[model samples]
Target: MSTAFDILVALGGLACAGIALVAGNRIGSVAAFVIMGFFVALAWVRLGAPDVALAEAAIGAGLTGALLLRSANRLGPVREAGVPIAVHGIAACLSLALAGGIVWAFATGTAEAVYPSLVAARVGESGVSNPVTAVLLNFRAWDTLLEVAVLVVALLLVSGLAPVRIAPAPPSELVLPFLRIVVPVAVLLAGHLLWKGATAPGGAFQAAALLTGGGLALALCGLLGAGRRTGHVLVLAGLGGLALFLAAALGAAILTGGLLDYPAGSAKVWIIAIESALTLSIAAMLVSLFLGPSEGVRDDR
Candidate 1:
């Protein structure tokens, strides 16, 4: 039964991707892509990685779909340029090469995968029972730090693009009431996820994604942006996470003679502090990217 269900999911995902690739309607293609993301997320969950599934659903499907919808709105239903035969041939060749490489690796590689065992043995020392959290905050923190840096860089790139503001429409009677309940719930869930991450399947990225969703909702509803001061503060918050992480690295170097190393018996405190700061910065950066730099943030930055 499980195998059959998995097969059904795989086929459904493939169908969605095919539709997205071939659909003439821009809005329809975006919707298909978003559904594909959900299918992929479900696959991840079935594979026992709920963290990855949550991140995929929230960031990949929800936010990315929203961005594409916004872009489609601005660009209208214009036809994209046709691809050349030579380009298609080149892409096909690349796909074939990738598949051959994967097959070759599986046929030739015989070594046992030891990473799970290794993580299990050492996760206790990392101040988090969740192996994913342990690796992100302790065992292999450099990668996560670099990921944070990448988000900041991406935000800066987005800032260079012109803002795409939606034309104001008549306020819906249900919009305010909907936000009143959902925004607070999102905030509460985000905080819960942040705290629960030490032992369970939640973390900064997932929590920040929730926060970004709520912020985007508010912005869309015209309840968010007000003055230059608020914009400036948002910009600062967007940059604050990386700054805090760098400072923490320097402090860790002083205390433990290595970058990002927590002091003895205090790893939890360090991880929680860093994660909390990162959550806010990441959410701020995402919101700023979507809204673009307002007058206050643009001039200051």
Candidate 2:
């Protein structure tokens, strides 16, 4: 049954990708792409990586689909000239070559590995019970810190573009009540994920995604304003994670004698604090990414 399920998921994912590529309409294509992301997430789960599956579903599929849909809506429908058959043929050949190379590499690679044992051996000193969390937040802190910086840079680039603001429709009676429930739930869930990350599959990225979703909901509902002032706040919030990480790195180097090396016996506290700050900063950056740099008013009515 497990093998059959895996086969089904693999086929479904392929089907979704094909549909997304061939769909005549942008909306249909985007929807199929999002479905493909879910299928890919399932494949990740089958591969025993729930954290990766969550990131793929939330960031790769959910938020990315939202961004694409927004762009599509803004651009409106327009027929485009199709690629030439020769161009398509060249592309197909290149893709096949790439696939063949990947297959060859995997077939030739050895299965020997030592990182797992090393991580496990030093897990006690890493301040987190979860090996994945310990590696990401401690052992591989530089990579994670740089990833945060990349997100900040992406937000800056996106916001630099002049925003297209569509005035939000007046909220109906049901909208406010829905926001009241969903926003709080998202916030609570994010916090839970952040805390559980120390011992489980959840972490800052997942928590940030949920919080960003909530912030987008509030912005759509006209509860959050977008303007120059708001943009400044967004910039600060977006960079806050990187700034905090850098400060921590320098401070740790001074006190602990190595960059990002937490003090012995207090690593858990430092990890939690950094993760908490990252959650907020990442959430704000994601929300700003969705909203763009449009000047807008908050409608409380």
Candidate 3:
């Protein structure tokens, strides 16, 4: 018998597909996507990974949907003409063949245990209980570090395209009180998360994202202004993490005859220090990207 979750997942995927086909130009698409996100979350729960589910909902569906909606508003509905019969037929046949092949492969494949044992064996040494986190930050740290650098580069490219002008919105009477209450609280929370990440679910990426949220809030409320577009601060902020990583590697080579090697008994300390710098740099780059070219700014009275 098909389980409730299986039914929900199938129904949600089908509904979203249908909505995209019929009313993709209208409001139905958004509704369909929201349903898709909810069903995906349910599937994550069924898979027994609530953390993945939370991230999938927060980032995959929620943030992506909001971005798409904003883009849709900016660029109105698109129109496409009907395709030629022969072309359509060929495309449909190709798509069906691909789908059939995928189904057949999965059906024929035998189940074999994989990955879990390997992860279990090494997870303790990696210093993280979460296998995914362990792999990301320890076993495959160089890859993850490069991924972060790519994000920084992308943000830099975006910032170059449109520099943020600090247009301070006039402060409402409640602004000061709100900032006073929230800024300190956010700082405290961010620091706690950063420190907790070593042995907990939280980490540099999550903590940086939270810090970026706070920075964005401050920018929106006109507490922070976009100052100079390109300066020593900006350049150093962009390169700080990379520089630190290279320095660590070189230092290791000089002291221990290996690159990127932490001294014995100091691995966690080194990792935390690198992550802290990365978190700050990432937060700064994200905020700068969001704010876009600065004109000479004046105080918002």
What's the true lDDT of residue 208 in model 2? 93
What digit string (tens of lDDT, one per residue) describes model 1 on residues 147-209? 999998887776566364443355599998999999999999999999999999999999999
What would the TM-score be for candidate 3 when compared with the true structure?
A: 0.72
| Candidate 2 local lDDT, 1-301, one digit each (tens) | 9999999999999999999989999999999999999999999999999989988988889999988888778775756877899998999999999999999989998876799999999999999998889999999998999999999888878766746554567778999999999999999999999999999998999999999899888888777775577766877888888899899999999998999999999999999999999999998888888887546344222
**Model 2 segments more than 4 A misplaced:** 294-301
Error of 3 at 161 (Å): 1.4
Report how far off residue 248 is in candidate 2 (Å): 0.7
Number of the candidate with higher lDDT, 2 or 3: 2
17-89: candidate 3 lDDT, tens digit per residue? 6675567464567767766776787788778776566556654565456545544554545667756889979
Ranking under TM-score, best-scoring first?
Answer: 2, 1, 3
Ranking of candidates on lDDT, top first: 2, 1, 3
Question: In model 3, what are the clashing residue pairs, if there are any?
Answer: 163-292, 163-293, 164-291, 164-292, 164-293
Better of 1 and 3 by TM-score: 1
In model 2, the Cα lDDT at residue 209 comes to: 94
Q: What is the C-alpha lDDT of each candidate?
A: 0.87, 0.88, 0.67
